[model samples]
Target: MNVYFHTFGCKANQYDTEVVRQAFADRGAVVVDDPARADLAVVNSCTVTHTSEAKLRTFVRRLARGGQGLETVVMGCAAALDDGTIVALPSVRAVVGGADPGAVLRAAGLPAEASLPFPLSATRSGGQGVRSRGWLKIQDGCDEHCTFCATTIARGANRSRPVAEIVAEARLLAAHHAELVLTGVHIGTYGRDRTSHDTRRTTLGELLEALVRAVPAVRFRLSSIEATEVDDPIARLLIEAPRHLAAHLHAPLQSGSDRVLHRMGRHWYTAATYRKRIEWLAERLPILGLGADLITGFPAETEADHRATVELVRALPFTYLHVFPFSVRPDAPAARLRDQLPPAPIRDRAAELRELGEAKATAYRAARRGARADGVVSGRQGGKVEVLTEDYLSVYLPTAGWDLRPRFEVTVD
Candidate 1:
């Protein structure tokens, strides 16, 4: 049998897809890139927002029409949260929870292995396939009690993969010549669940230290860390670590107002403290890229609060932003808030922040002009070769005798 995997949403989902794909391959199923050519189509879905849900529906509908003879399997956070909506779709043959991807494979007539001996191991070699970037799952799930989030419910309690296991996977990724990106639902909470009574629990900083020591040749990037987790030790390692360490950090500042944060049940340092951490990192790291997540038009977010958020975002040194309008999930505390902003105001605020984000990104790219940086040449585009720097900056260089996959130090002039 031939299978095609469609992945949507976070890096963790993508990582899960890889695990499932490898499982199918182990069972003698050929992986195909085209849906029409496959016997089965599995969509690892994401429901971070309504827009993502729509996309999943559209893809399933299209696949159903295009892949008339194939079985369609739907699984992931989106499917887990709203299984009835998806399973009712004419195309979907099976709906499985995000927590049990292995079950989806089994239901689709694939092998029913209890679990892979090492889930993080990838079957693809030589970096010759569609995946150039690698996502390493160091942690899974969340323990934070944020009122507006559905992730905690979708992923359950915090679970940390052992440090030795992560190190082994990092070594494998390094050997494959792929840059490894550390990812999790709540990555900052690494080691909290696995701590022993005899020893102080290992922290994200220590885990990172172990990875760097185990696989010094691999470029390592973090998916995202909470603002509260961006402490001194981690900050210093990010600043002074070897060149293989990614020069980018994504810290989410859900809201700028203390009242809004408190209402959301998110515990973190004050906006002032968050600002200082960003400043400290920017000053220490070379060619640093700072990204942030922001939510606009939350319940009880006064006009003054919105204004303060805009000011704080503008004053900060963030190179990019992921702006989202607050969406109330079915069972979340924020869903019942009485003072929710109207749809028009929410849309307007999100649009404003998006515009601001674009301008900041352009300014950051402009600053890179005339500076030299190291990047891996990924592919050819329009007679020029494209490369991505460690900090995730994209650069285009004229394709003149440059090796396609060579790591080169290029001047961004």
Candidate 2:
């Protein structure tokens, strides 16, 4: 039997998909490249936002009704919601909550044999590795209770993998994936479940230091971290370790107004505190790819609140912004709060924020003109190699034939 898979949501989900894919392959099922050609189609769903949920529902409907007679299975956070909702859908044949590979296999009528530890060979493709990038999940779930987040409800409490296990995987992946992103639902909360071998709490920085030493040749990047999690030592590591840790930070400043932040139940720090930390990092690592998440039209967010957000973003040297229009999920605390925003104004504000983000990105690219940098070549297009720079800039380099390699030392001109 042939199986086709489509993934949604975070890098953690991407890593989980790889795990699920391996289970099918081990059961003598061919994992096909196209959903249309497969006997079964599995959608690794996302329920992080209303838009994401709507997209998945639409895609599943289309996939089932396309006359391919596709047996559809849904997984991830979307499938975890009240089961009856997604499971009741006529298009969906089966549903698995969270990241359980066995459920997926059983749904496909494949043998539910014990999946061997992900083979070091899994990272290898065509005698190389992942070829582009590898996502390794080191932790899972969230402990934070952000009022607007539905993910925490679906994913549950935090749990971390042992350091030894992660290191072993990294050792093999280091040779294949030019860039390895260390991912989790809440990466910064890693090691919160485990006390030290000596009883001290292990920090995220400590994990990185170990990973750096274990795989000196690997280029590692964190997926997304809270602003409060980046303490002094973590900042030092980012500045000092060029070959190991990438010089890019994606910290979500969900809102720039303190009142909204309070309403959102993110009390670890204020907007000024977040800005100070960003500024401190920027001072040390100039040209750092500083990006953040912004939620426009949050509950009771006034014109002044919006302006505060705009001002904070403008003052900072941000390379990009993930502008999201607030959408209410009925289960979330924010959904029940007062003064819900209309769809039109939320869209307008989101658009404005995106335009501002584009301007920042353009300026960032322009500033890097004629600068020399090292990047991992993702693909070859025509006479140019597409390289993702250490600082996360996507640029094209002129090259051809045998000289084109996966990783490159080139100049941005």
The best candidate by lDDT is 2
- How does residue 380 of candidate 1 score in lDDT? 66
Q: How high is the CA lDDT of each candidate model?
A: 0.79, 0.81
| lDDT by residue for model 2 (1-413), tens | 87888888878887878878777776787888777788888889888788888888888887787627778888888887744777766568889888778888887777675554555234644322226668788888888899889888888889887777888888888777767898999898888888755266677888888888888878888888887798766787789987678888889998889999999999887999988988888889965888898999999998788888899999988899999999998768999999998888888888988999999999998999889787887666677767888788887867644364667676775
TM-scores of all models?
Answer: 0.94, 0.93
Runs of candidate 2 exceeding 4 Å displacement: 113-122, 126-130, 196-198, 379-384, 398-404
Cα error of candidate 2 at position 366, Å: 0.3
* RMSD in Å for all candidates: 2.1, 2.3
RMSD of 1: 2.1
Model 1 backbone overlap count: 0
Clashes of each: 0, 0
Local distance difference test, candidate 1? 0.79
